[model samples]
Target chain A: MKNGAVLTVNDLRVYYDTPAGTVKAVDGVSFDLRPGERLGLVGESGSGKSTMALALMRMHKPPARIAGGEVLLDGVGDVMELDDEGLRRIRLDRLALVPQGAMNSLNPVMRVRDQLADGIRTHEPGDDRDALTARIRAQLARVGLDADVGGKFPHELSGGMKQRVAIAIGTSLSPSVIIADEPTSALDVVVQRQVMETLRSVQEEIGASVLIVGHDMGLMAQIADRMGVMYAGKLVELAPVHDLFTNPQHPYTRLLIESVPTLMAKRALASIPGAPPTLINVPPGCPFHPRCPSAFEPCDSEVPLPTSQNGRVVSCHLYPGEAA
Target chain B: MTAFLEMTNVSKVFSAGIIRRQHTVAVDDVTMTIDEQSPSILAVAGESGSGKTTLARLLLGVIPPSSGEVIYRGQSVDDLSREQRRTYLREIQPIFQDPFESYNPFYKVDHVLTVPAQKFQLAATKQETTRLIHEALDMVGLQPAETLGRFPHQLSGGQRQRVMVARAMLLRPRLIVADEPVSMVDASLRATILESIRRMKQELGISVVYITHDLTTAYQIADNILVMYKGSVVEAGSVEQVIRDPKHPYTQLLVSSIPQPDPSLPWGAEGEIAGDPESMEVAAVGCKFVDRCPVAFAPCAGQRPPLYHEHPSRAAACFRYDDAPTLEGENLDLVFERQLASQPASGSEEQAAN
Candidate 1:
């Protein structure tokens, strides 16, 4: 909604040093998360949406390395340049992650209260034990969980309950940016909406900018103000959710929007023709050219850079411009 | 004799924690039936502990019913003979939720299709076997060349799930039980898998028992739907009838909770997973959903409600349907309409929570 960038990735590249080949997982991906805005990174499986999220948080582990580009918070202090201590300091305060499969991430042996307290203690050691427990209970209550829930173990909690707990922990520090990777994919629709609502409420309470990664464009449209369409490790389109669905600029973006199953029994849920390309051996030019129906000569010969058009940053030969 | 498959007052009880006497009534007395000649999709939709999975297990004959019976054709599953059991295996097939776990990672994907054919004696010659495998794979939108020799890891989530469908097709089963088949697959890829399941009915004349918690997908694919809460079937009807105009409060809550792709229609606050776990244990009698149901009255706590027939094609277990006929539709509509009316265009109450 505003020009202030809570988090910005400038031509970020994360590659997997595999035995087969150097797999470009996040190939020159760039996007900005504005304050109080929810941005969704929508893509298919193996499309590197998750990889881009990990790179943003500097969680891209071994076998995968950040090859180039910068990750800046508020257009200052490159996240890539930070040391382990500085990275830890930057995390949970400025940048927080609600990890994938978050329900299973909690320690089953420990009580939910202890786990929440553990996270709070690691970040804010100045707070006393009682204050931390009170804060934990308060956070749990905010997500619709009972105060008694803090006393129980993770194993005792349901999938939805655990997910809410994860959100509570992720936003406990009131971080400026919250990156949730496939947060609601594991829960049912009833629980899914509940989790989404909880995430939204928590984000709103903290006024945090959220970046959610998911494969469902329709689900993303519900929470995200703007969505980035990632395909085979490249962001082909970035636009408002309504605009992305209605007036899609990129070919890959068009195909994805057309695939959603709306309530009205919208017909012709077209498949994307081919399987997602492997990062190990990506296509020569545009990684989506193999599946793109409107693929032309330039699509095969040269990779299209991010060109701004109609308030969207689209990377395609079709939308050729650099104006913002 | 008209009953192809019938579940009469079926129930399942499992012991909880370390106490043998402390039992959890997983699936309560639920009665449902599939007509003989009319083979169509019967979807069992529910939340996590709603017994949908339990019903699928009971249907597959993997677990015996603690009470009542599952009647197949004219015979009860508990009374099946040795020969009947063999025939039953071919008559009904199961498609599990996770694709990767369904098959052996060590074996080639083709083994799943070919082994069933060899065991069932569906094909004799090598050429015939090849043709059958190719056809089955092709039916699910996978090519034999690209998919056959590969391991489960080699394929995508959609591809692996389709292989499972192809394996089921090899048996040429009369019925298929797909339990949350697309829950693990990507959303866009769901259309392909669902289309494959739909094609089986038209091409092979096989009825599908689709068990899932996703209402949107159910609306898209299901012919009939049974919505369960805790362990009780709260609503059952034709897909359009139940989703479009729900009779039960639980169904209404479910229909309302669905994140409409349209940003303009914001969600209601009442049904954001606010149920108390202790509510299920408070009583042995009455509605399973009484605690969580927004419109629940005094009778909801005292006695269990019967499935009141709303439309000719639909039935719901809410006392409000017939008991409280005085509450006009317009009033209830106003109550629900107010939630939608109050909803902001884009941002939810979460925005206001700030």
Candidate 2:
């Protein structure tokens, strides 16, 4: 909390109380966001990447609950301690969320400009309407959308255009922190590149800390300054973008990197065996042990603690001499 | 050499509205061949409305082409009888884009694999059917026991996609029309599905028509590549030859537009490559890509270039290659230069200087 970090989460745990049992979506995960830095949260489906983002924003529903965590937003105090009113105040003005599948997030009947205006009016009351409108127009332009799109309904715009509008809405308030969940997944390759670039440039322009949750490593590699690789409900590796891609430490991280298709490497793609374990009843010991090619006896019996090496933190027994 | 599946001038047009005033040319005059021996992975690459999906559907005989003919095993697809059509379907299977949509959500994942076995009567008993399902599942890297009873939602996106691949493999089809098969799966799991397709092609001699907008994945898995723009093939060749040295301007743009994984390299900010939506709305005599073609000449706006032979195993629809004495004589540098010239003076000069 005292450091220059924009956001810091410590010993975070989020669970879902399903009919099956208590599902540990995010268990004992921790990471930090520096001011104006872009941190990518990457994992396969059900890797707790999205869950971590939701928990940080305290957006989980009745069935899904944050078991324990300390989400400290710099200058604003702990996010977990905030009530509904405090959370609402923090949402648009301080921390903005670009939800996943935002193409469908907009109301079909409402004009996009009105939606943005409504969001602003609800959060920052009695603000200059014209000034806010001008800001919205600039934001839309920044994301490669024209100002005329503000008058159109959600259904009138293409998927890519809608996503850009979503970005415009999220960044309209100039929040201190922005959490974008799978922002480019629904877009085509060309639009995907455009949207990611826009998101990165916009974040830089605003000087706001950004958290991107997605499964696409290539897209993440393009924007992320640092990246966190999650498996099941734990943070397996957290390192600079280059380090994660070039010299990944965790077995899961290595596997994930290897599995990504790129123009440079044309070798036979290797898939990690078995699917991700269900959160309802995650496997004991190391969550990734079942799929980890290098997993040994200790991996099935003991959980590895995150150990730091050269500014990178890795939670794996593969890093020898690292304590659990 | 006689190809296994050959589509000649195949086109599909769908009409909407009460007056039928609007027409969508989903597939337009596409001609390609899948050879018999040493079958290659042919990728029909394009964005939405590029007709790649419609072309796949046409090739699979799910929806017949409105014009021209699809030849399967030396016979026209339309000429086949009911029994012959069934046989053709058995030989040529389709792997849809969404695995979740491919199967009923209520049914277990194994049901998809089991139906083919039952229909083909390949299994004498329930045990044999189960065995066949397991074998197919194993081929696609899915454990039979783990996936058998699970619903679509129960399995992860990767697992569900693998199951769909298993279903496709159950019939032992000689050709697969995989329409953006891995697009929906997680990026970490996409390579695995692609690898399965590659393995199926190598081991089982199954030819795959991989339809996708992702040029990177196309480069990874395809042997032969087809670059489509507005329902027509602009370029076609060996993946290595085409991707490494793209002949057509459209292909070049696509290849360059692919975002490099290296962060050091600048994101190629060649202004938005705008395809003429209006051109696709109405049939035209000229090239479909003329508006977007940076190297478009006067002739490009007047006449649609034919898919002429470029090399021993390559063909492209570009005026640049038309006058070359030999396909190798075609000047790639000159095309790139012409393209640079066609761009607005300010941006091109700045880009060139950079």
Candidate 3:
């Protein structure tokens, strides 16, 4: 909470109990989200960025367990230590999650109005019907949706509209922190731009810190103030948006940035040579060392601890001596 | 020389619902051609429900176009002989979007390769078939030993898609219609897969119709670009011309909306998502993009604009180029400025109200 950090995650570890062994989905990832900051988590599929988001929300299922971590919210205490009832009370009030798939998250049977009202009543049950209805309309308007949209089911709306409804529900209570997971991945380019604009406007109005998780580096670069690069469940590098793109410290981050196809220039994409490592049997030292171009002697044998300086964190043998 | 493949005025209509039939024009009056002599990558870029997939289906001969001619090697695909049909099927291959769903999970990955080999009679003996499979796999950068005998689920998404490319390459097809081939694969692996496709065009002398919703990928590998909107081609030109200086309003929106991977280039003013195209029934008379187009005019609602040739190589389906009568072209900016000045704002508002 000090230095105006809205959320602080320290040494977070989320493990999935598979039949083979313990798969480290999220391994020792740590970062602080400042108030009103838009932080992006960029990684490929199975890189554990989504797992980190779920673990932060304490929404991980039975097979997936949070091994150890401290998700400390500013006003609310450590979320990892909260019980079922305590967690429920603070869920929509302090922290909110806008899930990956809008169709899956929104209740198909319930009208959009009732769904919004239901979330409101769960947190603050004293509001009468008229007040609740007004609140629902306001929430709908906040996400640039017409009030009549509340009358329609999830099936009736378009993909972008459904995503907006999801955003409306997540921010109905004006939570301190909003976690959007691939919010516009399924939408068209035009619609995706509109949706991201809506999200940015809403976040600015509420002044809430946002943690967006997705694989699209272009999208992250456009929206996020700072970005964290994850490889094989590890947070390899965290820096401001410009620094991350201009001078990527981690080899994986550099390759990822280069690999992203751009409209500016038609150059041969720098594809990483090897396949993404499997979580169940990750390589012995740094997970990215095998695929890294600049990997050296200490990389394959020793796990590089995270080192922090000037608001940037990097975990690699390339940058040694300054340990966290 | 005759073009390898050409679709002239292609249109496919599908009627859904039982009691009251609702017709959807999936592909509307589309015309494209690829030369047999010049191997190139032609990108058909569009959003969902834009009919790019329907166009791919038409090219693959999975479903016949309701109207228009699909000519393969200067012969009507519909009028091909039995032997010609077999040749057509083998020559033009399709690589679909989802690699996981493309294969049957119960069968090992080798089945996809062997079955195609046997059906096409690419190899005579069992040993010959094995060698072909191994050779195809090697061409895609997949180690034959590691990739073969594994189930589709066991191989990574990138690997499975590569296997699909290798299968298509097995027949040495003249043209490959790859529909969103890299969309489902992971980001890191996309470059490898696209590289393989590009390699096919360069090395094997195979043309490709690369269909995708992502323009960045299209701009990366495609030689020419066709931007589609609601089953209609809004713009068609070389990748550099279309992407750098988009003519049509829709193409401009698409180019501007792409989230560039640079902090220096931020998104502009907020854009509003218009009415859902699926729910709003489009009339058969006018332009399909008039509802969402920013620079739509009074003429757009009255009649569909033909593809006006702005330059020798570039064309756009918009009224702004209608005044440029000659192929040499006029100052199109003057025409655009004049059109915008004369347009009434209430014209679009009235159309929306209707």
DockQ of 1: 0.39
> What are the per-model DockQ values?
0.39, 0.38, 0.69
Candidate 3 chain B: 10-residue stretch with minimal lDDT: B331-340
Q: Distance (Å) between predicted and true CA of B119, model 1?
A: 0.9
lDDT (C-alpha) at residue B2 in model 3? 81
How well does candidate 1 score on lDDT at residue B351? 37
Question: Worst ten-residue run, lDDT, model 3 chain A?
Answer: A315-324
Model 1: colliding residue pairs = none
**Over the stretch B1-354, how does candidate 2's per-residue lDDT look in tens digits?**
566788777889988899757787887776666654554577889877788988888888888899988898789988998888888888888988887888798888777877788887767899988888888889888778888988888888888888888888788777888999998887667878998998777666667889999888998998777888887777777777778888888787777666676566555556646653223353377887877766778888788887656665667888878864333332121111011112243333224322
Best by DockQ: 3
What is the Å distance of residue B19 in model 3 from its true position?
A: 3.4
Ranking, DockQ, top scorer first: 3, 1, 2
Backbone clash count, each prediction separately: 0, 0, 0
Pairs in clash, predicted candidate 2: none
Which has the greatest TM-score? 3
DockQ of 3: 0.69
The model with the greater TM-score, 1 or 2, is 1
Model 2 chain B is weakest, by summed lDDT over 10 consecutive residues, at: B331-340
Misplaced by over 4 Å in model 1 are A1-3, A266-268, B17-20, B269-274, B277-282, B323-354
